[model samples]
Target: MAPSEKDARREARRRAAHRRVEPDAAPAGETAIRSDPIRVTADLTPELYRHLGRHASRAAEEMDLPRVPSVDLVRAWIRVSDDPLVWDKVIKELRRAKQ
Candidate 1:
């Protein structure tokens, strides 16, 4: 006895359908982390915009890591530049990076 073409097609479809269905497993006990979105608006000169993009790309490449959101990076920049203490700390860190 041989299977018909229709039966083979149906069997293949059944196997594919079964593979597509995910197994319903109970979630392991784990806490989900939550984060709030930060927003900002800014206007930049063309040169400054290019500089920011390059800085962000270099930051991303240094560790072959995920890129930080531009908003977060910009917020960080503003926070550091606005505070003398923070700027001093940043300069110290940069000096260390050079060594």
Candidate 2:
């Protein structure tokens, strides 16, 4: 039996969703890393939460970092904590050179 119009539209959507890009097809100076996302939950005491808020605010003022929520700071730390060596390298470079 012939496929219905709805089936054709579904097939088109699936193809579009699964479309892959070749690295060479990217424009100059562009690179891409593909990975699945991970979700984690945290529970902190009220004191620690307050501490994080104060520290984040102080860092923003003293270090000129943008002020983000404490939870965001925690989330970002968790994300970048995977590579301590790279973090150290970048921190050293940033300290040596003006951003």
Candidate 3:
């Protein structure tokens, strides 16, 4: 025995509806994480991702040791990369950490 066309259509609609937002209401004044998702258009090599993951892990470890604002971390990274002197200082600090 085969399923009817109506049954198939109903199942499809049900699946589509299920994919939509849930009906459960949320309490007022609740907020979630604010940072936007980072987009990457170009393909990232496996090595690049590995390096990024390592860098992020190290930064997270440092943050755990000494809690710092995410904005401050981002600003520091930007500033250091923009200035050769600051970049040198940052590299020195990283080397000191390894020692």
Candidate 4:
């Protein structure tokens, strides 16, 4: 039996998702890292949310980035936190906040 229109659309979408790009297809001076990114969620106050958005926007403009996603900024912070000095500072702030 012939597939219905819905089945055809589904097959097309599946094929599109599976399509792979050539390793060298990235634009000049750009490196593409293909990896599955997992989602991380955080709870923030409305004021903090606005602050994050504004910070990301300003950084994006200053750095000539096409966009500065909040996730990217948070990931950068995580990378920085790997340093002993930054880690210590974060712990100090946490302790002070608890007092």
RMSD in order of candidates? 16.3, 11.3, 15.3, 11.8
lDDT of 3: 0.62
CA lDDT of each prediction against the hidden true structure: 0.69, 0.68, 0.62, 0.78
Model 4, which residues run further than 4 Å from truth? 1-37
lDDT by residue for model 3 over 21-65, one digit each (tens)? 456633322322224566535456898666655666678786775
| 8: Cα error in model 2, Å | 15
Model 1 — which ten-residue stretch has the worst lDDT? 25-34
Off by over 4 Å in 1: 1-38, 82-99
lDDT of model 4 at position 61: 98
Better-scoring candidate (lDDT), 3 or 4:
4
Give candidate 4's total backbone clashes: 0
RMSD (Cα, Å) of candidate 1? Answer: 16.3
Which regions in candidate 2 have their CA more than 4 angstroms from the true location?
A: 1-34, 79-99
Candidate ranking (TM-score, best to worst): 4, 1, 2, 3
Model 1 residue 9 CA deviation in Å:
62
Error of 2 at 93 (Å): 29
* Candidate 3 Cα misplacement greater than 4 A, ranges: 1-42, 65-76, 86-99
Pairs of colliding residues, candidate 2: none
Query: What TM-score goes with each of the models?
Result: 0.39, 0.37, 0.32, 0.54
Residue 96 displacement in candidate 3 (angstroms): 26
Work out how many backbone clashes candidate 3 has: 0
